[model samples]
Target: MADHRAALRAVVTQRMLTDPAHDLAHLDRVWLIAQTIADQRTNQRVLLAACYLHDLINLPKDDPNRHLASQQSATESEPILAELGFAASEICNTQHAIAAHSYSANIPPESPEACILRDADRLDALGAIGIARTFAVSGALGRALYDIADPFAEDRVLDDQKFAIDHWKTKLLNLPAEMVTDGGRDLAHKRVTQMLGFLEIFSEEIGHPLPINWKSV
Candidate 1:
């Protein structure tokens, strides 16, 4: 499996034009996380290809075409997969995994490999890494860290597009429930706990205590 990844890694590192949050390092992390959650029945080749190419067409969070990025990536990966000598069926599975991995894509993962890839990709959007990625993306887009008057959206709408921290409430905190595998859910819960802990200190640092409702998992 490691040898299989080496060639794909080179290709991804060479060709992917990406944002800080969706760089080669992000692909590597997704591969590692996918391994942890992958069961015996999982196909390593399909998972590896999907993880590396999932963000081949990385789009900004605010892109009107953001929801289509995954599908585009899936389409784009076909030639690469064929070039890499992947069987037709393997390529099909890999494409499905890539296409179904995005939250915005809203495609249900029907295959085990797709489910694992989706969970793995979503896992990267939580915990400490998730926090860093959120801020990186927000900073790139010139979004504020949080609403100064309502950091937790206590009285206002949750708008992650404007405030980086609101992403935690808008999507990140709820990812565990969206996980496909039991192991993925378990790990997501643990990561959410870590994020909540970070928020506790973050809230205090900003001179506002975390709301009691959000204090625990």
Candidate 2:
């Protein structure tokens, strides 16, 4: 397993896109989280492979073909899996997990491994790490921290594409409800609590304290 992990890391390091929010470190964290919440029946090997390669074909968030990235990654991983000595069944399962892990992919996770992979990956989009990632990606995309006039979108529709903070209300804060596993949900709630705390301080520091209703999960 150590050798396989090293091999996967090498492959990822060689091929990962130059996105701060989706680097090798992100993949490492996702794999770690998946292991932590995985059930006894979960296949660690498949989960590990999927976690490392799920973003194999990384696409810009605003790309019209963003929803297809996961499926493309799944296809791209086939030859790599074969080279890594994966069995036919293992390769199939691994590809399915990778293809279904994306939020935009809209593919249902049919196996426990796929569910865990999805939950773990989404978990990365919450808590302190999640906050950092949100800002990092937003900065990369040339978005503002928040709308100055109505930071909480009080007067306008939420638009994460233009404002980083709007993403919390639009998606990040809502992730707990979408978690597939009980463990993932529990962890997501804890992470969201931290995010809410950050939002309160952020609002106050900017002289635009959020509405009381916007502070909780």
Best by the TM-score measure? 2
**Candidate 1: residue 72 Cα off by (Å):** 0.5
Candidates' lDDT values, in order?
A: 0.92, 0.93
Clashing pairs in 2: none
Which tens-of-lDDT digit does each residue in 164-209 have in candidate 1?
Answer: 9988887888899999998899999999999998998999899988
Q: State every prediction's TM-score relative to the real structure.
A: 0.97, 0.98
The lDDT of model 1 is 0.92
Residue 125 of candidate 2: its Cα lDDT? 93
Q: What TM-score does candidate 2 reach?
A: 0.98
